[model samples]
Target chain A: MRRLAPAVGPLLLGLALAAACHPAVAGLLGDGGANRPLSLTRLSDLALNHLTLAASGFAFVACLGLGLGLVVTRSRFAALRGGIDTLAAFAQAVPPVVVVALALPILGFGGPPTLLALAAYGIMPALRGTVGALESVSPEAREAARAVGLTPGQVLRQVELPLAASGLIETLRTAFVLAVAVTAVGALAGASTLGTPIVAGLQNQNVVAMFQGTAAAAALAFLGDALLLAAGGLARREAA
Target chain B: MRRRIILGLAGAAVVPTLLVLLPLMHFAPNRLLTGTAIDAPSILGAMLWPLGALAAIGPGLLAGSRGRLAAAIAALACLGAFALLLAGLGHGAAAWTAGQPPAARARLAAGAWIGASLLAAAVPLGARRVDPAAGGPIGALALAASVQGLWLAGRLDALSVVVEFRARRDELAAALLDHLALALGALALAALVTGALALWRRGRGLVDLTVSGLQVVPAVALLGGLVTAASALLSAAPALRTYGLSALGTVPALVGIAAYLLLPLWRGLQGALRAPDAASLDAARALGLTPRQILTGLRLPLGASVLLGGVRVAAVQALGLATLGALVGAGGLGTLVFDGMAQFAPDLILLGALPVIALSLAAERALSGLEAAARRHWPS
Candidate 1:
């Protein structure tokens, strides 16, 4: 790694500097053509839409997933696991196009259906994470709790839930990132987000707007993930 | 317990097939002089074979574990009987429309389509995954041959999907092939990258994170990114345009689809190898196995199912994403969808969506079957 970096590092730096200094960089980074390039106002508007949409959708996913996960991990719900796994996997496999298209007719094309689709899409990974992490908790841990004076409910609440919390947070990070990115599809269904320019550009064959939209959306996702990682680190540090 | 599950599944299949077919006009006239759909006298007979198939399962259930042959036969009989009934319905339609005008042909109503799909789904659900009833090559071949034979006999020609297919036979055929090609091209590209990344000993985390991050990018933005990058590349290399590789169409579509595959494929490989655990790997090292020997001898072969699981996901995803390739003029089943959306024709949308769904399901089932077979016979 050390030897290769000496030869490659400066080359990459020079390329980045060269590209940043290119003639098209400004227009490429801007929202669209010179007539209506992205202003500070529009960028903030899109970033707000992107973040809020993801957060709202993520909230629904967290609740639905956590509730369902806790329910199905119960001993009585053992038989339900296979069906839930299949259903969630199926939900995930379904292309967002179908979801948006189908939802448009019933939900009548707006943020609701987009939110519906994102929440639906986001719930599966969270569910799988919660269930998997909970199940991976050893039987000995459960027995030790039982050997203590704790009731079954108390044991699950204090021990299993805390143990599973780390993995669930990671899953939510994934779900949030996914919701933010997938909201781009919602733009096609008439919901305004960072994807507005991307889908519109695709539809109208405008490459400049597309580049800008793509960059903005990617940046939003990057920032969302970074925020999640920082939050996770802070939580871990506080616990430590 | 096995018998009870098998019987329960069989009973479940019977209900839908019966409910959808019975008491309805197999082909009701659109000219319902009244409010309700009034059926012709002969339409009531469509329930006979389905009932017969249901009855066959009764006897099969009693035969127990020894009745593997009986269960297989019952499942086949149900599906075959359902297919024959559908064919017979087609024959009736052809006869009914024999003297009609050239433009006048009877189409299976939506009910018939629903019924047929239920029967198709039921056939698979009826088959238990036990020995002999696991649906072997012979059963698959028979099913394929029968489906083809029905097509040859024009038995399936009366369906609305067939009508739409006939209207654009050449285009639909080309689109189907194009869809397959696009999927394969994307998979090949992804597999190449995944294979390289798997072999690399360093920066695995960085690669995994980047790939996963790429996955979270929306399909639209990714496509846009691809287009932007392609345009930039095309502008930089004017000579490449002379070779028939344009900025749009297959090139960008393949790259876009490939971007989605890298994450799953890489994760699958990493997970599969990691399954052996560090302790086993260390033991292998102690035994003096070279790294190449370890990877080829242990990881790749033992982890075959894990790898295929990723490929299966990739393949199924590619099948659906290939539909989006049509938006860029790559011409796949997605053309049917976008065109249908453009024209606001629901049937045209179904025309596209149904086949894509079928292809995705088929790819998934086939991959799963391959994984099961590999796991059964794979080297330890």
Candidate 2:
């Protein structure tokens, strides 16, 4: 059960993506509007942009979470740690609509803000996992590192982090899946992503377009999840 | 002692300033405030005075031996003040009374009084009893004040304030103060409800049921449904037609979207409760407490981290979802996005999208602090 649970993300992603490309499925792409051939050019553009956004969001969140996780562990400053975590959670709780509304007047719109929101939303899982994983590292291992004259940074880098890597990777995978799923929502703000088709489909009540867009989104989410699971597995093996 | 007091006061001042005041200062309504046609300032003053009175009564309730009784009285006084203030403000009341005969005002006043009385009766009963062992009265007062501040901030119209500020930049400081108060009210209400619920239920399913159900509903679909429902209700009932509920766009859409965003927080808390260590449960049981006692005294304290963690998630989600409010005429960031889309203006879209993103990032940072605090006090 445990082993298979990890495979769900990847399996779902692959199947959905593959299904989107089938000839029988071309009817689902929604009106296709003026863009003819339903060609590989558009598909490639989407795949590339989607991947880039996902990657950027993923990388940003991972780094943010890492720094935050480290700060939380090293600093005995309870209030500071508490404050940061609360902020992150509140950020997570806020409806994406509200964030966009609140941000519109200040930051304007576009790829940057959308990416920023995705990155922000994505960080929580990884940050949380890092904290939990690091805390769970055996105290004895930490003490051994200390007794051996390892600096605190050295202890974290050489001992605690490596031991906690598997858990951290799992957390990142969850974040990645979430980011991929929500990236489509970026279309609502006009980021020129796959969600554009879906939104257009909804506005026009075009079922084919809606199906195409939804299928693409679901596929992307699944693929992203799968990739993360594979990465997590590989990391676990490396740790072992 | 002085340092601690100073620190507390600073926090009291700073939090509202950043979250509510700053936003309001940046967006206070210019036309409404500047126009001589309405007694807007006087109305506002009338509202604030009674609210201030309510705030004053809070401390006495917290301090007295008959705390529950005192709180009940204070709550009643607050409700009475709120009614008087609302009546004096006139805008909300006028809107409510529109198209209705003058005779309805008496009924409305009576209804308001009855409602206030019921709310007062409910407050003390719902108040969480302070743990006798948990430090001094100062801590309790601080908690109460914090709650009040948050409540004040959250319930305010931040968008209107921001719009006002944009139009009248000179009044930025006052606008910001008002906005802060509103945001504080919102935060306070959320905190109080979530905190109180956490204390009472301790690992129960209410949060999960509410939040997860909310999560599964897609935002667009939810908004559509809400708009449809609002239109139907308004058209079907003559009374609602006066309020213009059938008006399409931002308001209805935003309300729907906001409703949809609540699920994750609810579910997140539920998930957190389920995530706690089993050993802690056994330990509580071993201490000779009943299940109810165990939950209130032990599990709740232990689970505070997770519960709050859930809240942080919900709050961030809510912030993001609020941007979509503009689609239904609720008017927030979605207005920018939708308008940009209509006109094919990338700059406008970027303008709208950027703020949503920044707000989300900022919210994430804020919630991170809450999560950390939860972990600290309720160490796994």
Candidate 3:
């Protein structure tokens, strides 16, 4: 049972994705919206939006999180650090869906708000991880930099940041994967991301569109997570 | 040092100044009682926020640790003053429109929004070096000040969101209740599953990996899968339909929420038990405590805080995820948000979004309090 349960989830996910592509299966399940099956092009376009939003949003968030993390970790903003941490985690705890929902009014319909939501979600973990990583840096390294006549800024840039790179990279990897997953739900707000099929399918009772969308998204999420995990591992190895 | 100070001043002034100088508020004749007025900063309105921000910084830089308390006081005062001023402006706007329909209200112009956002930014900027723990209270204060400023001072009451909320008060109330129900229900379900999983300690590593893996699953896809699986089950059994089980309703939504929440609770439980205060357990055993006694009195009591922390995380998570249940027609606050969106009502979206925020934050606070209380009572 122990060996079996781990494999079961992915296997089920894969099977669902595969079944979504089958015309007869989609029909049998009453694939609701116009009873139409998603084409390869449609799936790919959705994936394209999904990837674009996730990549760009993740980049913006990671950078922002890093900066924010740096500021809060500083002696100047010391008092604000715990608040920042709680707020960030609180932001994360508030699901991407709610952010996207609130943002739509200000950002209007489409991919922008989705990207913003992804960024909001991404910032929390990135900030938390960056702080953790920077704090984990040995005091010896910090003292050594100070002894070498390095300014605080210089020490952060030259000594501490590079050493913290692996942990920071891992954080970004998590953020990137999470951003991609969150993007799929952006469809409800009118972004043609992979969630397009799923949201549409759910709305119109089209099981086929729903399954195809879910399958493609699940497959995409798994692929993105695996790639990130690999890249993070490799980066950590090199940094070490 | 001079250059650094100069750069800091520029960084602070740039955004708020542009917000003031530019068209901050856009008013339409129909949207408001009077003709469209953009950036109506009667001499004081324009100076108020910037001056308030400046006043906050001056005291902080002048005083040291002693000044921080004064600065904290100053920060709260600035936020309060700004909120009151903003509220007054909103009231004026509403009064002017009194002759016109109540729905005919002024929309937020660029200045009003950017100014407010800039003001919010200044709240943190006003803080002096103090205990980091104060961040929580300060955060609460800032949030209250800004939201109250926006709602009462800014006349968010006049917005379409409030209008929709007012119109559908019953439904909105129901949605809030529904939202709460789904969140608590899912957390309960997750607790049950995690309890079951706790028996199989050796399988924990795999469980953790699988749970984290699921965390990365796109929410839409997860919902889709649950919907499909439920439909498939109903089709196969036909008897399950009698139990309020369906592909598109509360059951599937509950399942989705439960699955999402399980990860946090299970991990929290596992981590709590893994170490179990070895010395305490040894002492308990030496004291001739029965296995059951240790399990109940020692293991459970010691693990309460850690486990509750997990529950707190899960509770917030469930609260958030429960919003998605609206997509599946499960009737939560998301339904109001989607409904508002479809009708082009921003106010309605807030009607839904605000409650979710309030509930999530409230749950976070409540659970954190419980966790703290449990720890206090437990033998350290």
Residue A25 of model 2 has an lDDT of 74
How does model 3 do on interface RMSD, in angstroms? Answer: 3.1
**A1-240 in candidate 2: lDDT tens per residue?**
454467675586468655765435756443355322224566557656766886788788888987888888885444346446745754565444444433443455557756766876677677888889888899999999999999988998889988988777777766776676566666665676666655664465444544455555556666666666766666666666
Model 1, span A124-224: residue lDDT tens: 78898888878877888889998988898998977786676667667777777788777887887778887887777777666655655666666666555
lDDT of 3: 0.71
What i-RMS does every model get?
A: 3.3, 8.1, 3.1
**Residue B237, model 2: Cα distance from true site in angstroms:** 21
lDDT rank order: 3, 1, 2
Docking class of 3: medium
Model 2: per-residue Cα lDDT over B289-351, one tens digit each:
798897677666776777766566555555556555555555555555566556543334444
* Among all candidates shown, the one with the greatest TM-score: 3
Candidate order, DockQ descending: 3, 1, 2
**DockQ of every predicted complex:** 0.30, 0.14, 0.52
Model 1 residue B85 lDDT score: 54
- Of 2 and 3, which scores higher on DockQ? 3
> Residue B263 deviation, candidate 2, in Å?
5.8
lDDT of each structure? Answer: 0.67, 0.53, 0.71
| C-alpha lDDT of residue B345 in model 3 | 60
